[model samples]
Target: MTRRSATLAVAGALIVALVAVASFFNLPYVVYSPGPVEDTLGEWNGQQVIRVDGADTFPTEGVLDLTTVGVTSADAELDLLTALRAWLDPDRAVVPRELVYPEGTTAEQSRQQNAAMLANSQQNAEVAALRKLGYDVPEKVVVDAVVEGAPADGVLEPGDVVVSVDGTPVAAPEDVVDAVTAHEPGETVQFVVDRDGEQLTEDITTIAADDDGRALVGFQPTPGFDLPVDIQIGIDDRIGGPSAGMIFAVAIYDTLTPGALLDGKHIAGTGEITADGEVGPIGGIQQKIAAANHDGAELFLAPASNCDEAVEGNNGDMRVVPVETLDDAVTTIESFVAGDTEDLASCPAS
Candidate 1:
């Protein structure tokens, strides 16, 4: 062969080998794409997603979908070709693996965390929905986690219900914080906790907060509620997260109420909900918006904090309503059903 032709052939071979290697090389990123949109008012695996007992439920019309984003597993390897494809697709997103999984986190640990978050979200959703309907849900402060080497590390354990602190009754998680912060650093504080239905008292010295000078017990507390009614949420075991709290609350409210909230219109949303009806921002808002739009959602409810991302990700196929609270969502849905769109908050409002 001629020298020029031989060089050209070698270059072509190198290019082919590079392409093959690129296709097989694993990237340190994760891909996120539009996932399934499940209607809380409908059924999953032939069973109602939301079932309430000890209350009268009326037949509801329309869809109240809780949108989700399909994320690559914590341990899943993404090749260069797959990453490139995800980057090119406007509906898909590529994020660093560390951002999603963090350092030293195993796939099993990630799944456990997600499951715990999902369980807590479901409990909070029920509380929010029931309280909005005039039902009382009494709550107590429960220990969720204790920081190692901290003051409460050996004293407090998870699942221990904080009944009181320094003889002050603890009704909520904030109560525990307030009780702890009321004392100065190095002061020993008494905590009465319930462990496995048995009452126990323990004392631990307080430590100064790293960010501020306030006293801290060095443990995370979450609200534990005694729900007035029995509400069961049937969702796939594969889907686990707190982002569906807002939609779960709304769906439960609709089931308990006498009228249809959506009025046969299709709607989808994503947000973490507090017991006080506040809507919190969640991850993967862009991918969720794409999922909702593709799943035939006529209107989408987005947390106000996520409005900017939602607007940027939207394809203009569906209207995106920005909601700050559960009340805002109900009001928006009611207005939409009534055909009154004036004064409603929308993403990219101009």
Candidate 2:
């Protein structure tokens, strides 16, 4: 070959080698970093997510809304991104974000950081609201226990209100969770509680950590409350988020009352119910319909606003009864449980 041709060939070979190296190394120029791949989306605080109570809103008491709400944080987002990257390419080296970490971080660290951030957000909201109302809302001691996994594992037990831990008084829910997590498993911890409005003391042994060496308490503290009306309302004051809680409360109330709203039939629904009896829309209407169908729910109830999504997503396989008000949800559920309408077509889809 000519000298000129030989020089061009060598240059081409060098270029190809560089490209290959970049791609294999996952160099920024060769393979662009993909944007956020969300495994789970956070809930919106001050926003209501609603669901209908049952198949037909007639017989069922009404819509059930979720009252617990959460706010988003930038740190939480970064933490999620870091987790996703670690999961996608564990062995690969990752450039640090805002934090200066010359050494690589473990998945556990990322998770803890995210949890602390979220807990802080929740604590801040609680504190600000409580202080505004001139009431003292004590921090709750949080324990995470697995059922059948440990002695402390179970839903927040009755009459368990955390007053202090290890002689250190906690003022925020996050503080309690942080303090409890400070100890390793198998350590005995002292907890001061206000049980049934009475001051009490208890010593509970922490359980062994699960697969992860992280200590497990086997139970979480459900925050106890001693507060004025404003503080009480503030805790429950998530905007548009109380629909499900309202519905559940109403259903329980209805069931406990002289007449029955369930009518002995399995009914399921989603919607937000206001304290004043207003019904609101909720997300995942289609997914919820699928869940109800899978569970053999006789009728599915959804908000009137979410009716379109439900109908479009279900493809006419399920009965989606839509309602505008909590009263409407109740009336519809009542009608269904009474066995008046057997045809699903009769109920309005949207």
All candidates: CA RMSD (Å): 3.4, 16.3
- Clashes in each model (backbone N, CA, C under 3 Å)? 0, 41
| lDDT tens readout by residue for model 1, 1-350 | 99999999999999999989999899889998988888899999998999988889988899888988898988779999899999999999999999889988888999999999999889889999999999888888899999999989988899999998999898888888888899999999999999999999999999899899899979999989878799999998878889999999999999999989889999999899999899999999988888888888888889999888875575456888899888998998999889898877788721
After superposition, the stretches of candidate 1 with alpha carbons farther than 4 Å from their true spots are 1-12, 145-158, 177-189, 195-198, 202-220, 314-316
lDDT tens per residue, model 2, 1-350: 99999999999999988766544442111111211111001122442221223212222333232222122222323343443454464222233333321235454554465454333333333333333324454445433323565655443354466778789887656666677678888787777866567767767677666586665556555443342322111122222222243244344334324455565555666665543345567644544555455455566667777776654343244467777655566577777777765542323442
Give the Cα lDDT of each candidate. Answer: 0.89, 0.47
Q: List the residue pairs that clash in candidate 1.
A: none
Ten residues in sequence with the least summed lDDT for candidate 1: 308-317
